[model samples]
Target: MLWFILIPVLVILLILLISCICIVPQATAYVVEWLGVYQATWPAGLKFKVPFLMRVAKKVSLKEQVVDFKPQPVITRDNVTMQIDTVVFFQVTDAKLFTYGVERPMAAIENLTATTLRNIIGDMELDHTLTSRDIINTKITAILDQATDKWGIKVNRVEVKNIIPPAEIQDAMEKQMKAERQRRESILRAEGEKRSAILVAEGEKESAILRADAVREQRIREAQGEAQAIMEVQTALADSIKLLNEAAPTDKVLAIKSLEALAKVADGKATKLIIPSDMQNLAGMVASIKEMVTDDSAKK
Candidate 1:
């Protein structure tokens, strides 16, 4: 009977001991509450709590987290309505403050983000809002970081995810883009045509220069050929005169040769003939002819 009673009590104690001990994981924190009031925050590793009076109020993760909020309709300063969504990156700094400072922290953050975004967009015009996303994100992050400091949340960065304008505005933007692209294409084509014309003009100029050079060279070659022919004829005549002088022919022999040249000239169909005064002696001409005939007959 005593052993049975001791065993039951020992098992109950073991169960209580196990229930009182808590093991916190890495990058995790446990907020403890005693008697429905905040007590202490337990960090990673082993922790002990008084059973039946102390309990973990909340488990906070210390890692950075991202939250993407839904799109909210906002009116710009120019009274243009647009939808904008945002994303927030944050980390828990103090586990105790995070647990007790705010109720439903994620929902509170979402509401805060929407309100802050509306205020920022309301101060800017539609065109500015569309173009200044980075500026808006920086402003929002600074505001949120300051506001959430007491809640033990650090706002690392904020991003504007998407912005949607009216359908009429989108159509107008597309038409403007198309006109701009066409203008650029026209300018490029004109530049290309101008470059092509320049190249053609240069090529024609070069061809004209080459043709002029060729013509000049051909004329020079023809003149040189004519000059060489004249020189050759003069040299042949000089050689014939030299051979005749070396033969030492008498005056009568010279007169015979001159007569032969005159006879060749008279063979042409000329209307007139002029004779030299020396050939006016008919008897001498006849005697020379008879002598020429006698010598020819003797040789035969």
Candidate 2:
């Protein structure tokens, strides 16, 4: 009966001891509270707590986390209403502060983000808001980081996910863009036509110049050929005159040769002729020969 009573007590003690021991995992933190008051933060590995006196209040993750907030209505400086949503990346730095700093930290961050975004957009026009996304993101991240410092939440980055302008404004922008693209296309087409015309004109001008050069060359060749022919004729004439001088012809032979040259000139298409004084005498002598031939025929 004594052994049975001791065995039951040993088993109960063992159960209690196992329940009091806590093992914190990696990238995790445990906030311990003693008698409902803040005590110590337990890190990874084996940890011990006073039995029935201390408890794990909250388990905080040290890893980075992301929160995507819904779209909120905002008005720009130009009084243009638009809807914008954001995403925030954060990590827990101090587990104790994170546990006790604020109630509902995620909700607090969302509200703060919406208010800050409105303030920023209120100072800018619609055009600036649409174009300066990086500037807006940086400004919001800086503000949130400073505000959440006491809460042990480090805001690493903030991003504007989407911005939806009014439907009318979007349609107008699209039409304007279309017109601008058409204008650019027209200008490019006009430039291309102008360049083509210039090329054709240049080609025609070059062709004209080449044709003129070819004509000039042909005329020059013809003139040179004519001059060569004249030179050859003059040389042949000179050779003939030299042979005649060497032959030493008598005056009668010279007169006969002159008569032959006069006969050749008379055969031409010319209507006028100038007779030499010696030619008249030669003609009279030819007429006497004709009369002598006639008298001899009669006598025969």
Candidate 3:
């Protein structure tokens, strides 16, 4: 009977001892409370809690986290109302502060983000708001990181996810963009046409220049051919006269040649003939020569 009671008591004590031991995983932190008050933050690995005296209050993650808040209505300086949503990247820096700093840290961050967004939008016009996302993100991140420092929250960065303007404003912007695109297209088409016309004119100019050059070359060739023919005729005539002088013909031969030339002139289509001054003497000479030929034939 004594051995049975001792065994049950020993088992119960072993179970309680095992339950007091806690093992924290990687990238995790455990906030321990002593008598319902802030005590110590246990890091990853094996940890021990005082039985019936200390407890794990909260578990905090040390890794980076992202939270996307819904769109909040904000009024610009120009009184234009717009809806804007944001995403925040954050991490827990101090586990103790993260557990006890605020009632709901995420809710506080969301409210802070919305309030900051409104304040920023309230200072800028709608046009400026639409174009300044980087500036807005930087400002909001700085403000949130500073505000949440006491809560052991580090805001790494903030992003402006979406910005929705009114329906009428969006429609007007679309129409304006369409008109601008059309204007650019028209300008491009006109430039292309201008280039094409210039190319055609240049081609025609080149063709005209080529035609004129060809014509000039042809005329030059014709003039040279004519000059060559005239030079050849003159040279041939000079050679013929030199050959005749070398033969050294007598007066009778000369006279007979002159008579032959006169006969040829008489048979031409001329209306008049110019006889040489020695034509009468030539006729007497011709008669005497004919009488001599008659005497010779009688003797033969």
Deviating ranges (above 4 Å) for candidate 3: 1-7, 194-300
**Candidate 3 residue-wise lDDT at 290:** 74
Total colliding residue pairs, candidate 2: 0
Candidate 3, residue 234: how far the Cα is off, in Å: 16
Candidate ranking under lDDT, highest first, comes to: 2, 3, 1
Candidate 2 C-alpha lDDT tens digits along 1-300: 899999999999999899888999999999999999989999999998888899999999999999999999999999999999999999999999999999999999999999999999999999999999999999999999999999999999999999999999989989999999999999999999999999999999999999999999999999999999999999998998899999997655566677678888899888998678786778865665566668789999
Instruction: Give lDDT tens digits, candidate 1, residues 15-91.
Output: 99999999999999999999999999999999999999999999999999999999989999999898999999999
The total number of steric clashes, by the backbone 3 Å criterion, in model 3 comes to: 0
Q: How much lDDT does candidate 3 score?
A: 0.93
Cα-based lDDT at residue 207, candidate 3:
100
Q: RMSD to the native, candidate 3?
A: 7.0
Per-model TM-score on C-alpha atoms: 0.66, 0.63, 0.66
lDDT of each model, Cα atoms only? 0.93, 0.94, 0.93
Q: Which residue pairs in candidate 3 have backbone atoms (N, alpha carbon, C) closer than 3 angstroms, thus clashing? A: none
